[model samples]
Target chain A: MELIKVTIDNKVVEVEKGTTILGAAKKVNVDIPTLCHFKLHDMNIENKPGGCRICVVEVDGRKNLAPACATDCTEGMVIKSHSVRVINARKTVMELILSDHPFECLVCAKSGTCDLQSLAQQLGIRKIHFEGKKSSYRLDTSPSIIREMNKCIMCRRCEMMCNKVQTVGALSAINRGFDSVVSTAFEMNLKNSTCTYCGQCVSVCPTGALTEVDDTARIIRALADPSKTVIVQTAPAVRVALGEEFGMEPGTIVTGKMVAALRRIGFDQVFDTDFAADLTIMEEGSELLNRLGKHLAGDKTVKLPMLTSCCPAWVNFFEKQFPDMLDIPSTAKSPQQMFGAIAKTYLADKMGIKREDLVVVSVMPCLAKKYEAQRDEFKTNGNPDVDFSISTRELAHLIKQTIRDFDSLPDEDFDRPMGESTGAGVIFGTTGGVIEAAVRSAYELHTHKKLPRLNFEELRGLEGIREATIDFDGLPIKIGIAHGLGNARKLLEDIRAGRSHFHAIEIMSCPGGCIGGGGQPLHHGHSSIIKARQAAIYKEDAGKAIRKSHENPDIIKLYDEFLGTPLGEKSHHLLHTEYFNRKK
Target chain B: MATTEIVLKEKQVQQIKDICKQFNNESGELINVLHKTQSLFGYLPSEVQVVIAQELNMSLAKVFGVVTFYSYFTMTPRGEHPIDVCMGTACYVRGAEKVLEEFKRQLKIEVGETTLDGKFSINSLRCVGACGLAPVVIVGDKTYGAVTSADVKNILKEYENK
Candidate 1:
């Protein structure tokens, strides 16, 4: 690789050729403020439209200021990052942006965390020299995301995420000039569009323009209801990311503290979604083994490479984009929905409470879980299995609202039965975890052998897509795992083209499974945070006594007492769901 | 306004597919394909863009973005007799804004909108290379020079009920 020397802010630095001015500046520790330029290093994801001129730096002898984010440095390039001209131009650009933006930072949902607001404060912008009519649009509230396009600064990060990253096709830059804003087709409601409620757009948005629909208040209201039995289930990914909201280090595991917080927040029960993750493995594993058996017997009709339907966004993606191959995915409901189903059915029955009176709330690291809870199929009659689903960020807010010192709280165990989970179930938080959990169970069930080692480290990584062939007593059962929906699209295309040889595939919509999910604490364009969270998940997994989902005592009891057996009639009705063709 | 359904003919659909194929079905050629499709069909509707997106293997939102980004492309159908009211700097200084408003009032439609009867559609153009004829209003192929607010009513009368 070629290297180029550049002088930024009188500091000489040598960087690889094709490195952006922003990259070269970082080598010498010159921090340049930027917006509309986001890159998750090692994930092959970047959104640099060069639309925001806030990161402009003066190039020596150049007539125009170059956007540091998109401008590549050449040999002997002289860049003045904090020159008088550069500062004035940057502040002027910010003022122009603020001129059209609403001054509602005091009450905005993205008040402190907003990238644009921080940039304004970093640049010491106190007054707006340019005031103009701010463009406003109708507020769109979907099941998972809220689209407040009026707050949009035209960064196009969400547009890049929705189109290039996730391939959801739910948002794009529409109109032109001063009236330009990102929107769906005809500015239609996102629920009406092909949006999977993935929330990757919300995750990448720099302003309050895109956000998860705040369901904290609804959860609070449920907690306040004296007649309602509010039980909260926290997803595995939530534990690692929830601590970030409380100013804790990234990847700090706060599972016990989160449980204690939920209890103090007035929940009747605090359970782990990992338990339902175990239940999912039980059902999905059985289904996979049954299919593998049929395929091994030369059953040509059986769909090879059964896709994991544990991700609601992934399910919605295939339903809309690859409707013809809907039958290929395992029908097992997601951990969130399965928890809801079992909570409202078996747990409700055991507690002797009416299903209508039981308010089952889920704290997930995903925004799609909110949509999944509200899915019509997950509801019985008019009552949804899960009454409300809140994000990890919301749980942090709830912890704050409860006025308890999260730092000083005693580590408490989750309530009995539903709280019990194995290391296999807890790994569901990261990419390749769900499939790894399945393989742990499927390997033993198919080959009828207790393997030498439990941990399948070969299946684990932060890669977008991975394929591994595990020997089920020399049967060579191939498994494929894709984290982001874009990667899933590639694997799906290969499957459609008859080039795929995998027996089963695990697909998660977010980049790094639920840990890097949209509803998790914002990663702030840092890939290391996601990597740290993944490491925490593995650490939590290694500390557990039972490492396989099938070995969980609670899950075994549930199957023996309530579910009867994996893929049995009762489990099928409650834990399985069918897909629809949403191609329009 | 609600988009009315237009059942495209087989030949027109084939032409759109062929246009996309001409660009080798690459998503990067979205602008060119949209331009050709818009010129061929007079407008780029959602259904038409959906076809182009499928052919190009791109998302519909992206296709919609390219279609809406350029002012040259539109989703609404153009009328048989399209009216262009120049809103260039010279035209605006020459009271083109008032003339444009008068046309809106007379036609009972906003700029870039067509009449209910599908006879006349109004548009605010930048310039027709006719700054000499400042505040110009072009109806079909004929240009009315130095048009005023009062001239808007007569311009509509020429294309009315024809």
Candidate 2:
């Protein structure tokens, strides 16, 4: 790595040869606000990547203002970080981005905290000179987040975050020129496509263009419906990330308090997605072992590489984009779906109540969860499984609206029975959570011996890809874990190419797993982003005494009395699902 | 890009069921059947509205009503080649508008019309998601971002050639 000399505001700073002016400036704390940039991600440079003109900075003596975020700071390069020319150019960029923006921030789900809106205010460009040419497209309310391109600034951050980081091509610059709109394939409704509502797009959105549709009030109304008993469930990822909304630390253990807060908000019962996560492990693990056993016995008809179906977004991607791989989707329902499925049947039958009277609502860290609730196969009790799945952001909005002081909501505990979950169940919230949970069970199942250490450190980290080689029985079992969809796409393609020797792969649609879910609470431009989200998950997992799913008595009781067995006929009918074959 | 693959469920389907119930299960209203089925399926999927037409005792031409009359409906699957002609004010003033008409003429389909062979679908876009580059056309994954009438031949040829 050769260092190249570069000039910035007349200061001598040597830089990496290909480092951009903005990158070099960040080293010296010369702050340059950006709307089109993300952590470890870069904008897509399709046909010279222009038109955004953001990060535009004036290069000394160069007639054109260079986009600092995209341009390389060369040797002997004279650069002005905030010159009059640069400020004027940046002002124009801000104005252009806002020209198309709806400016509907107050009522918007991203109100008071949108990237584009905040940048416009900072730029002191108060007027909209360009009322952008509008498109005929409607909001794409796919299974995940909503797409309001009308408020889009064309920063392509979502495209970059989704395509580059996630490896899912859910969005792209659809039309061209001034009339263009950010869309998913021909201006189609999201419900019709295979979009996993990971809510990653919402995390990167600069404006209200991409947001979770505000369903907070709907949940509130459902809770108040007297006729409807709203049973609230939270995914393991939520407890670690929800604390960020209250200015508490990110990844902080807010589980007890989260359950406490939901009860305060008037829910009859609040449960954990981890309980269902355990059920998923039991079922998914059995499915994997069954397939593995059959494959070892040379049963070619059995599905190999039983793709984890915990992440609905990844499932949609597999079904819609790689339909041939549909056969391998784990029949076990996702934690959220399983929560609702069990709540209606197992819980309902136990309580001796009609399924219709129970309006099961789940609070999750995902947008595709909204789609998961609407799945055709989830009608195990002849109705929708989880009725309303509000995102983590939506829950934050609800708390902000009702709670007197969100930061001061005293810590509390989740309800018993369904709420109680083991560390293995809690790990389900993060990437590689399922694989770790399964490894514990698979090892015990194969060897008939209890493993000592619960922590599977090899499968944990921020890496885009992780692999592990564990000795299962006498055979070395290979496994791969891909967090973001982009990595999943590469792995799947390799599998399609018949080269990957791995037996099972754990894939999550979002980077950093569900804590980085699409529906997490919003934060300041970058200041309020808690760096401790990952540690929080592992820390909470460490706090629990029980780390294995099969060890969860609630899940065990559910299996012993109601479901009977993992992958059993009754369990398949109630807790499993099928996938459709579609285009890639 | 997932939108290009059109598959309708409950909502678009309600139209057919609603119309059937409207006619008191009359299998004789062939014209009504065509209109209802086409309107329901958003340009009939091959035998989807075809099956509906047969069940309703409706003629294929009548079924073609809801499909052709409304711009939303399509008969064959919309073309895999999406020819988006940007006619935003800037591009419209810059000859992009007339270029679009010429494209329809060359492709043998009107604006919002897909070619008979299902190879091309012509849609007049307000903007090509790229404002600076006026008069753009997106053919599948490739968008001639800053397009012009002069560039139409090259753009059309690429899709036609492919």
Candidate 3:
């Protein structure tokens, strides 16, 4: 690699030829504050619009301060990051931004974690020098995400993620100059637009401009009602990442602590969404095998590559973009919905409680799960299967609001039946987990032989798209795994063109599956946090005695006592759903 | 601005499709296609922008973003007699703000707005290259030099019958 020497803060540092001054400053530990610069190191996703102008630094020969994020280092370059002139300009630009911004940080949802708030504190800004008419916009609340354009810093991070990374094309920087703001087409509500409610936009927004809808209030109300028996199901991804809120490391596994905290927070029964993940695998695996069998038996009518429907964002994506191939994805509902279905039916029936008296709440690593549970098909007579779905971040807030010491909480086990899960279920938090879980069961059922080894190393990785061929005795099952909606789009287009060769495909909307979900603890463009969470998920999976979904005792009992078989009529009614053609 | 549902002619729709095809329907050439479409349709309403987006294989929001970014583009149709008041340094020093305010009063419309009768629309421009004619106001292509608050009503009366 071509090397260049640059003097940053009077310290000479050698970096690659194309390295930005911001990247080179880390060598000598000189900090240059930035606002609109976001980079996911390993994922090759960077959003540096150079619009904020907060990272302006003085160059010796330049006419004006250059943006450190967009400026590349050249040989023998002299850069001063914190001269009085540069500092004054940076502060002035920040003041201008603040002038147009709303001064309601105390009540803002993203106040504590907001990048702009911290930057103002870092700059020691006491009072605004300039004042103007702050931009006001109509508050837009969708099923999963909320848009408050007044708090927008014009970072364009959400715009980049929506159009470039996720390929959702739902948001863009509209209008110009003082009126310029990121909005949907014609400033229509998100529900009317083609937004998939993936929450990638919410994940990247630096301010309170975009956030997941606050459903914790509704959950709290349900828990306090005397007539209600509120049960909460925490997704597998939440366990690995929820501890980050309490100043713990990114990969800290606090599953038992999370369950204990939930119990103390007034949840009548604290269960695990992992159990439902295993249920999903049972139904999805059986559906995959049935499709593969028919395809093998010369049934051209059946769709070949059966896609996983655990990701609600991926479901919404194919529904809007690939309406013609809607039948390809498996009809199995997501883990959140599956848990709600079982909790409201089989569990409520056993407890002799009315469905109306039982409230089902899910803590997920996804914003789309909120929309998924509220899906019309997942309800009966206007009652949703899952009454409410809160994000991992919101659960942390709720835990803090409960007068309970989250860090000092004692470890506790989940409730019986619904809490029991295998390593296959726990692994569902990561990108390759769902497909690996499905393969474990599909292989044994197809070959009528036990898996020699449980781990399919070929299917496990952080790559955007992966394909592996596992030999099922004499038959080879070609499997495809894709995380991130953009990567999913590639596989989808391949299938649309009859180019895909896989029999089963798993697609998750987030980058690293649920571990990198939009509702997880803010990584702030750090891919390492996501990798650490992925590692913790695998660790949880490896420590379990029962590794496969089919081997779980509770699942077997569930089949025997309640739901008959995997693809039985009862299971189909509770666990399966169909897609809509939202082509407009 | 209200997005009135205007029924575009078959020829107009075919003409937009031909303009998009002229640029090979590349999404990167969105600005150029939008310029052509706007020139043909007088303004880029939602219906016209929707056609461009579908033809270019882009989101309507992206197309709208590009169209709204540059001041040269407009989403609303311009009135029969469009007015432009110079707000450059020279014009401002010569009391252009007073002239603009007078026009808003007489025409009953703010800057970047149209009168109820659709006969006049007012907007502000940086410079008309007529620095000597400071405080200039242009009605369509005709330029009025050294315009004052007193002349605003007379300018409106000139375009009243036309």
Which candidate leads the pack in DockQ?
A: 3
> Largest TM-score belongs to which candidate?
3
**Model 2 lDDT, full chain set:** 0.74
Candidate 1 Cα errors over 4 Å, as ranges? B7-24, B87-102, B105-108, B127-137, B143-162
Interface CA RMSD of each prediction in angstroms: 1.6, 13.6, 1.1
Which predicted model would earn the best lDDT? Answer: 3
Measured with C-alpha atoms, the lDDT of residue A436 in candidate 2 is: 93
TM-score of each: 0.96, 0.77, 0.97
Worst 10 residues of 3 chain A by lDDT: A400-409
Report the TM-score for the A-chain of model 1. Answer: 0.99
Overall lDDT per candidate, in order of appearance: 0.90, 0.74, 0.91
> What count of clashes does model 1 give?
0
lDDT of 1 at A155: 95
lDDT of 3 by residue, A55-128 (tens): 99999999999999999999999999999999899889889999998889989999899999999989988889
